[model samples]
Target: MISGLDPSGGAGIQADIQAVTALGCHPMPVLSCLTVQDTRNVYNATATDPEIIRQQLECLAADSPIHAIKTGALGNAAVVDVLVEFLAAHPDIPLIADPVIKAAGGGDLADEALIARMKERLFRHAEIITPNGIELTLLGGDEDETRAAHNLLEAGCQSVLATGGHGEGEEIINTLYSHDQEPLYFYIERIGGEYHGTGCTLAASIAAGRASGLSARASIAQAQNYVLRAIRHALKVGNGQPVPDRGIPWET
Candidate 1:
């Protein structure tokens, strides 16, 4: 299930559904925030009522086995707490959370309270969290990404995969750190253009992989490979950013 919303279908739950469907998995969505946004940036976020959150989840549970869950943007602290409560109630489900702090066009989507809420509540429930370098620094403080992962693990998460998209280089490195093993580093040539819904795409792809019965590491590997291909075949949408041709065949 995806947590973020999109009016333009370029990001958030819409993009997540596209990615999940393309990867041959069923998508059940639960929105955390309904955002006014496009390829450019987010103007504002309106959170789903916390009380209604559990109702949607109950429906999702009744319908499917929901092999995996992917969350895109949790707009506020309250929504995050709701997520944590939901996870606590269903500890058996695996979750892939994309810790989105800022939009691609440089707009802040999460508030100050949002971060603290995640650490105190939601971080503990997630099976895997994907954060960018900026977020890593915020979560890690003075520690490195490796240290940050361990720190996050201490909070109760099983793994952390920090993405280095804002770095300067030809290659983009995404490092996965887990409590039970050494870090796994995956690399891909950085796609030069701005893209919409990439975080949603990657996280949903991971959920899809895991839903197909692949292990966590295997899911990350296949998801990484999938994102590279999606970027390579991306389509220019709107004036601001390229969106992956989510309809493209992602699995061979």
Candidate 2:
């Protein structure tokens, strides 16, 4: 997994590790950046040196067999470039990208340049790109959800999971879009209250499932269910938002 480090442990690499482990996969984490944040908001972030990022990825690849790759909160274009190069070298490794534009609490995690770079480079290598309503709009550059998702697909992403967490309704409707296939909708009851790291956990769970050899559709279903359960058992570690209990056993 390539992501930032969140000290609060509600999200980022911390959440990715917990989610992957809970799903019975070993997380090979490569830190792309570091954030100074809490459960409430991200105050600041610093991108890891691009060379260091490359070295870490190289070391991990040489040491273990990477089944899948998941990315979140890449702080800058340089980090995105590194990932693009890595993905180009290993095209067989599936990529699950959570286009984290802002924190769940409230703060910009990625700027316009990085977002552009993701679309122009990083996203084409992705097997699936997961983005919330707001992120979908921003990344796809269209206000209409369907158009936005389609825009991403046209840009070369194999699939797009446009999450409806930021939408208004009794149920959260997450739609999966791919070329020539009927859009699949997963209707989840909207759980009340603010929660952090839900996106990271969901993406990581999907990566774990893919690594375990599940089909993309099956992996998405299992991941959604896992995240729902984790949210139901959220931990109120800070005064701001509850953190999903990603450490909960998978069988539960």
Candidate 3:
């Protein structure tokens, strides 16, 4: 996993780790950014040094046997460039890039340049890139949901999953697109309350499924179902966004 550390434990790398573990796969974490935030929006974020990022990834790659990689909040262009080097070193590993450009509570996570790097570098190389509505709007090439994913696929990513949570819809729509194939859409009833960290859970769950021997499509389905339960069992913490229940069984 690659992301900022969220002290509230409801989002970012902490959330990714919890979700991956809940799905029963060993999580290999890579810290890309550090932030101070609660269940609400982020307060402040500091991107980790590029050299330190490289060293940590080198250490992990040399010492461990990792199956799949999940990326979250990568801070800036330089950090993303460093991560891109790490990705090049492990071409065989499946990567899930969760493009977290901003916080749910209106805090900016990355600047325009960083987002551009992510769209061009990380998204293009990963097995899958999961972006919510707003990110899709920005990264989505022509500002159209359907077009955004096609643009991403054209950019060389193996697949893209665009979540509908932040869109204007009666029901949330998750559309999965791949190279040389038409997009397949999945619909889920929208949970009524404010929510956060569901994106981290969804991506990491997919990573866990991939690590556990499921293909990208199968893993996506399984991860969707699991996210439903996690949302259904969401617990309110800090009077802000609803925290997803990490205790839910992802295998179901």
At residue 92, candidate 3 shows an lDDT of: 88
Give the range where candidate 1 is weakest over 10 consecutive residues by summed lDDT: 140-149
TM-scores for every candidate against the unseen true structure? 0.93, 0.97, 0.94
> Number of clashes in model 3?
1
Q: What's the C-alpha lDDT at position 163 in model 1?
A: 82
Q: Please state every model's RMSD to the true fold in angstroms.
A: 1.7, 1.1, 1.5
Q: How accurate is candidate 1 locally (lDDT)?
A: 0.81
Tens-digit per-residue lDDT, 137-201, candidate 1: 77766457677777888777778888876677899888898888888888888978667887788
Best by TM-score: 2
Top-lDDT structure, candidate number: 2
Off by over 4 Å in 3: 168-170
Which digits, one per residue and each the tens of the lDDT, describe model 3 over residues 1-252? Answer: 888898888988888888888888788788888898998899899999989989989999899888888888888899989988888988888988998888999899999999889877877679889998788878876777788778777777788899877766567789998877788888877776667899988999899999888988888888888888888998878878988888866555
Positional deviation of residue 123's Cα in model 3 after best superposition, in angstroms = 1.6
Please give the lDDT score for candidate 2: 0.92
TM-score result, candidate 2: 0.97
